[model samples]
Target: MKKTLAVALALALTATACGSSDEQDDKSEFAENGTFVYAIPADPGELDPANAVLGATNTVLAFAYDTLVYSDADGKIVSGLAEKWEAQADKVTFTLRKGVTCADKSPVTPQTVADSMNYLSDPKNKAALLGVLIPAGMTATADEAAGTVTLATKDPNPFLLESMTAVYVVCGEGLKDRSILKDKTSGTGMYPLFTSVANDHYAFKARADYAWGPGGAKHEAGMPAAVQLKVVKDESTAANMMTTGELNGAQFTGADRKRVEAIPGVRKGSAPDGIGEFFFHQGDGRAAAENKVRGALVRALDLNELRAIASGGDPVPATRLISLAPDPCRGDSVTGNTPPADPGTAATLLDETGWKAGTDGVRTKGGEKLKLRVAYQTSAGPGVQAGMEYIAQKWKALGVETELVGSADAKYADSLFKDGDWDMAWVPLGLSLPTQLVGYLSGPGPDEQGSNFAHIRNPGYEQLTAEAAKKVGASGCEQWTNAEAALVENVDVVPVLRPTQLVASKNAMLEVIGGVVRPTSVRMLKN
Candidate 1:
């Protein structure tokens, strides 16, 4: 009787195993069978963590790399490689996670963390965009025995964690080859790069041992075995790919929004607009220092119109440097203060600066033509180009000669500052936290130790930025408020509207993830 019962139990177990196998296959039909394809609008300019300035490159590279900590959709810092941290009076200690390895199979160590931070903070590293992440005079040290690192700052810097959100740690060995920055990436992220078919075509496979997944990530990730990202420069191409099932996800432009939303299985994700502006080089010893001319340039701009041009007909206009989300300081105050878009004011200011009209009908001051060259990174979108052309026309009506110079991506750093040949240009500044503004405001330039880009040196503004860096919570808020106001009143840049980020995905093949889904988040997805 015992033998007969055992035979029956074995049959039942086999039947149960068969049923489970069928269920797993049914649930994973799309993810298990197919490579998740994505259509990115442009080629990722750089994959190196240190050199990726454009959003497109950062979006893709971030998946293969990660910062120390990142805010989830709810804007709270969850762990990445470092499990948790403690901040004492003089030292900040981060406990490193174990079992995580880089794409090249190198283990993540405290020394690796220290080297990455040190490189980012070094002025010689040409990381001006990342300079804001380090506190002035801060030094990094590693305790290998404890698997911890302590960062000591000369002064009490309030936004250290916020800064770390931008600096992704890399293994010392991987960084020895900086050439990868120009074309590919290698980091210790959940996804590892597998192939680079071309400039815009790449693929990655999930690392089975990815230990630092964010809190509450879908267990198992049901992670796709393979992922593909395709470069499609035109918005229409990306939008079409979403409909035809060629792309599981993409970022949409104004032209693609209506059509993309019309698709049955797609949803949209949005991010705060990046700041855009027409920069005037004040260090050139030219007319940039003339207050009336600066005021006139400010008065002639219609921000509402400029916003429309910059967003490719998306009409959201920004009034201040700070975004209008959460507890932004008096962002509403700017709504009523923007200067009128009147050419008469521009002409009057030019007259006051002694730039009277000459026989050629162009403004002339001290034998120099009122004409100035306006340069922009050729990589800037159609909207940015349109905005520049509009401003050139308005300035021309006021007897100003404006010549537009377009530059390639490689020439951006040199053209903007090093060549020092430009009079004005449209440059975008990306500052994650309020304190990072110091690089543009007070840091030494290439020739000098500090960069006064706009040649804007207000002792008051510098002091306020410094004070903001020292305090936390309410005290920090107060200092930032003062610094923000000083910038607006001084007319630092033309103060064009900020830009937004848009990501679209197909709903049928996969579930849309939630929260502040950046392009980096999109790249890391399997389904």
Candidate 2:
């Protein structure tokens, strides 16, 4: 009787296993053997990971391209194509993993990696990270036989490894022809671009032979075969699509955040939001060039009230630019550096600066009314614009007249670089490390082809950053912190909210890995 009962139990277990397998197979028939869906707010027409500036484009490119180094969930540097690396005082060498191939099945030799480095190193190429991620004076050489790429640096780059994590490697074909990449990305990533429908969707086919994942991660068998990105601008529309079982995942921000979270099946995926604030123009000619007025501008707004509206939730006051996990030089740099918001003080400062309030309550100096043009970016959405309007109102209340302008992105860039018509503008600058801020800190003005948008030329801040650049790792954290302090103390930058990353998933189908979505993390789970 005991032996018969045991046999019955064994049969039951086998039947359960078979039933589970059948269920997965049935689901696979839906969309290209299970498609991982990503809902985007705006259409990132075509992904170009190498020069990605916006957060939306970077998310799409993350799956389509593989960087030289990987930062794990903890933001710890891990291996990618370069399986192993050695960093010395003057040089850093990486050993390219063997058998790695680009999306076109072309061998990713050491020479290919070296060629990518040489391409970006050229100033003419106008790579976004010209002086930021990629160090200024560096030459890359490859030994195909040894499967190694060597970078000999002219200056000591403390955050060299961290900066390298942002650079995605491309094969020679894509390197020579950038137009090919502009339409479709051909990279050493797991997914290759299959089709892109303008403003609709971007479909990708997974490479079964993919081997190189972050930290030597292997492509699991049950991973999604195809991933599709559906661009839905309206947050409510995206939430509706998720509830209707169309998309696997979506990111909802600002006012639409609560509505998306209310849906029963949606799961919230959170990551530390990037720090954002208005950086004052410090160029010699601008009205904001005066340190006192810049300080007054920051003080005029009611930040506590503004935070409630500007940010989706209770605003998390930003302490640093990159607050993501395992972030080097972690501390409260924003707290002490930022001055308390005082409207009364703002009025007094303007008065002290020879700009006295007239009968109309608008401050005036000499023959000119103290009027400032404030440009808010269109990409920040309606919520940020609403908040900026309130801040402008408060500025008006504080005696200074403000001309609020809703400038489109390209036009705003022109204002900073070409037109030079504005006194103040809102720009969201984000980076994973303090070292990356160096290029923006001390460089030629925007018109001069440098990232100094405000054309700030600060000798003291420049000196501090230059000294910080020489030391490696945590050794230079204090110097970097002090440099940021110099900017904040002088009111060059107004540190505001650290907006949280909001990723909403349908039926918990997809997950955010290492603060962003990746191909390896997507899987066909039982609903």
Candidate 3:
């Protein structure tokens, strides 16, 4: 039987059923290749979704796990493990899809779903998804007899499901002992972990019995029997592999995509991705805490020029944090919100803020010279390091000393959270909805906020998001947009540019969705 995927996600809670139909295709022309070769920028350490904070981790692990709800290319929630779900101000009810099994072949019940929720909601577990997607004060109750799991949140969360796309549901065995996640696999997803080679590659085998997937996507003939993530750090090496068909797909962010596509038997998978930016650390003792200082630091550079040289003009200055397809509040929040770079205004702002210019051109407040430490991840690419240095030079021109430091790939998260070493940093965090950023903006500080790396505390934003959370979908768009605008206006976040992520595949044979390669969706014709 063939059917079209659901548009508006059907909600079936408590004795009801979501009337979703599957669009089936006869596996006549589609070919099942022996293996699908993939190349990524770097190894996102550990497969454990709970402790993994990197976006690359979520993007890769998504192929190995299933969420409660799935999203379309446009960031709209469809259905995943749960047939349909109902959301409320503080409560969410989910109706489980029967016969879903874990990667280990264990039956997934309503209780199994409840356990995953409870584990993620616990504050002590330190799950990165906490407060980012699941929220802070969350609890769940499972009624196996009714086949429903009700999740109770402390407050209104309009975009919970949209954010939940990052919450990869796992079984109790791995949930209880998260350390096993580094070595073991457990989830009712499309593929299971097969073998992993240190700093080199990871292989996964497809599951035959699995059926639940985003928008009811299921395994078919063209789906690869196995998938390999080959970690090639160099851009040219990965690009050359894509051209040679040694790798089926490789992620390309810069103008290098053109070079790859220039070779025969190569096509690009293009989509919107979050930008690179320097988030101001506004916590106490942080140099960029004051709004005026933050403003000066942002106004010191011509962002267009920096992005041009750094990213090969492949990036668009961000308008909104969530730039995915089908976004409800899709508009230019960055244009009017982000001001034009003005060195004159920057100089003036610094002077008015009690920082007097010294003979060395560096400003001094009392006796201490105004110097800011800007940290960025080396793993982001050489372009990021070059861009940070460029911005640092621009700051020096404004009579402010800037220290451009790069964190090693291993200590990326620690430099921001553990060490408290950076005064400013380039960290791009994106979600499907505006409300997803609420927790990161109006939080206490980084030590307390699981996702608020900036340590931002905007009181007005708190009020706006609280009010908006009471409404759903576009009903709350204006409020959420205004709240984000406040962050830009106050110089809490000065985005360098939004990235237009591009990937190259051999002969355009692979179907990558939302910047992820789901094994279930990939089609390979027999060569």
Model 2 reaches what TM-score against the true structure?
0.85
TM-score quality measure for candidate 3: 0.82
Of 2 and 3, the candidate ranking higher by TM-score: 2
Model 3 agreement with the true structure over 292-333: per-residue lDDT tens digits: 888887788887888775665675677776644335686566
Tens-digit lDDT string for candidate 1 (1-527): 11111221111111110000011112322344335677655576556777654445554665677667665543356677778887643457788887667778887788888887777667677653344456546778999999988887776766676556556677635677666555666687766677776666878877666667554232153345566778787888787788887887765545667788788646555444545666566664678766577778767777777778876766656555543122223333245445677778777878887889988788887888877888876666677788889878877777788888877744654665466667787765544456545666555554564444556666777898776766653347677766766666666655666565555665323321111222223322233
What TM-score fits each model? 0.77, 0.85, 0.82
Candidate 2 residue pairs that clash: none
The lDDT per prediction is 0.61, 0.69, 0.69
Q: Is candidate 1 or candidate 3 better by lDDT?
A: 3
Write the residue-wise lDDT of candidate 2 on 1-527 in tens digits.
Answer: 11111221111111110000011222332222677888866676546555654445655676778877776665677898899988765677899888898887788888888888887777787666556557666789998778889987787877777667767788846866877877788788888778988788888888888888888877774577888888888878887887788987876665667777777656665555555577777777566888888888888876767776677565878776545333567756678777678888887787888888899988887778878888766766776788888878888887777888887666665676666677777655545577666656568766666666666767778998888878876778898888887877777777787666567765334445433566676666546
Worst 10 residues of 2 by lDDT: 12-21
